[model samples]
Target: MSETTLDTRTVPHDMDAEMAALGGMLLTPSAAADVAELLNAADFYRPAHQTIYRAAAALMDRGDPVDAISVNAELDKLGEINRVGGAPYLHTLAASIPTAANAAYYARIVADKALLRRLVETGTRVAQIGYTGEGEAAALVEDAQAEMMAITSGAEPEEDAFFRSFMPQVVAGIEDRANADTNLVGLPTGLNDLDELTRGFRPGQLITVGARPSLGKSTLALDMVRAASVNAEDPAPAAFFSLEMGRNELGERLLSAQARVAFTRIQAGTVDDADWARMAEAMPRINAAPVAVRDDVNDLRIIRSVCRRMKATTGLRLVVVDYLQLVETGERSENRQQDVSAVSGALKAMAKELGVTVIALSQLNRGPESRDDKKPRMSELRESGSIEQDSDMVILLHRDDFYDQESVRAGEADLFVVKHRNGPTATLTAAFQGHYARFMDMARG
Candidate 1:
């Protein structure tokens, strides 16, 4: 074919497959259910096929008979009988296939063609956007990626495994855990008590760590990242999306924490011989760890896109969004609460979609300061009700010395697991080594 002819070719479709699928549905009720599970009316390329499929689906949904006669009458009632070639065409479809057992297979072919058509449409739209240069380059790229992701995600088969199908895997997992040396079922945080209480952070969980200003919520989250990526017996890839702090600042904090060097000394460029030695010893591990840090982008869509790419490339295990309030969804809402709600919901969805544990640091309201005990609570999560609703777990952080300098628990911090959806809620204490810019388990300290 010539280039012009190829360019002008009709979009992908398999009319035979559409007819076969519809014929199978007309032959048997089970075939109709099977086809419906894999495809909808839009998957048919022909308008007549679309109308016929819709009529049959409507009849099936109402528990009515789904034969050629019933479908023809239904289409006629909806004034679409002539549009779909009347009763004779319905008979042609019923005679098109020999057996209904292959209905799902035929539906699969139709669905695949529909997916390709969607892909072509998405490419056309993206090309138009590129031609127009209507938005920022980064935003446009993100929008294009979002469009492609939507098509691929929609094409994925629905998970319809029976309960019995899951028991074997569950038993295998139990046996594996029983045989393993560690008790952790998910990625571990370095803080031993918190890890024990939360059973580490499981996949598809949105764990919110909330604290007031200067209480070291960022420090705590970074410590978890270090644990998962750098300190574990078998370290996993991790990502840190720092919206409130710069990359350099985060690097300094991570280095100081890992080396047990003073953060102030690192900040002032006054590291002495001992600090230099510790940092040198820690450098190799930090460099080898598959940890990605991005300090520039705050848009949630871009962040999610980067994360999805990372998950595909490096097998990302944990994601840390340093404080949730600063994340922008790239769309303005009527109120700040709504914006935060959208951001949190997207973060939760990203965690599930990527199958990674997400530790989103959150800023707490002033509820702690007003209380006599100075302990943060779940209700104090800044900006939105959805934070608590969306999160699988919520940890509230508090430090004694932060409130009273001479208190007995001077260097101790309390992490209250206020909302653990899968486990009991409790408070755990850790050593807040502020100078080192990290938290340590009390026993280790």
Candidate 2:
């Protein structure tokens, strides 16, 4: 193919639509502000359009006027007026549009073309990766999926949601909290004190539960997952992506907790008549619950795909990852800490993108045990400080009995709300039933 032919065919763009959108923006500042939410300067295929839109956006953001003269002056300040064919081009754009009423429509045209161009670029990159054949077949597939997902990730943009546009949601949320009998605004976990303190797990919130080994991190996560998804009055399906435990093992934990049967007895097939009856009773509730379990997933791409599918089908509200450090990020980094930081950042992003509350279990360092009190803090999060930084809530699970076996608080576990972004922090106690792998509300116990 000739160079000119290839240039015309390869890049996807609509110059008429770009100019019309710019003209609309120049004529109507209100429409410009709303359209800016859907399209950025980079979304314009032409460099000149990008320059014009950037100048207009800067003026609008600063509460300055946006018009041909003002935008021209801003571009002149940016030394881009001559580069963009001078003030004549701006006038031409304004003259091209008949009216500013179709500003959003024109902006949508520009956005769609931009997305198509991005799709072409992503496909090209994927083809290049496939041609090399350097990585494993499975890894390559994952990489391709990740690349496509990265392009589609911002499908719903809230970046430019102004306060006036956002006030209705805020007011509705406040009214929901006020009219309710309880202060829990989000999905309740069936644990009263913890729910009160944290106001339930709000959507788009990333919650990290960390502890040393065998300190009930998994147990606590399971309890909360059950409460939010299965046991809640109106069942909202939730996802559990377990990298540390197999599906059967996790099922057994839920079974033990629900049936109130001993875990050892259940695992050993030593259930008596009464235990069998309890298991039979528990089976119906467990089967009825809308919780999806997946143990094979250890990467964010797969996790995101599963969550997206679940949310579309059954209205998924929460997602639980049994331990963060175990996620396979599919990238080779210089150190484990860097890999963990990347994973944490990805999980946080996933939570926001999917609009689901994510609870990821993490491992704490030995700093808690080294201290006299043996209570964990935010700094004890293992591997990555980014875990603490990215999370909206950091909950530290500690059992004094785990360190001092003969202490008076043998079965009591202290859940320290170390870092909560929206509420007060305090330590709430829950009864840890080791035999059942259950964490129960202390008041009930």
Candidate 1 segments exceeding 4 Å error:
1-161
After the best TM-score superposition of candidate 2, give how far the Cα of residue 1 lies from its true spot, in angstroms: 30
Quote the lDDT for 117 in model 1.
Answer: 97
Give TM per candidate. Answer: 0.67, 0.67
RMSD of 2: 15.1
Writing each residue's lDDT as its tens digit, candidate 1 over 135-191 gives: 799999998898889886765545545677678988998899899888899999898
Question: Cα lDDT of model 1 overall?
Answer: 0.88
State, as a TM-score between 0 and 1, how close model 2 is to the true structure: 0.67
- Candidate 1 residue 175 C-alpha distance from true site, Å: 1.9
lDDT of each: 0.88, 0.86
Expressed as tens digits, the lDDT of each residue in 188-220 for candidate 2 is: 876788987888898899999999998989888
Model 2 has an lDDT value of 0.86
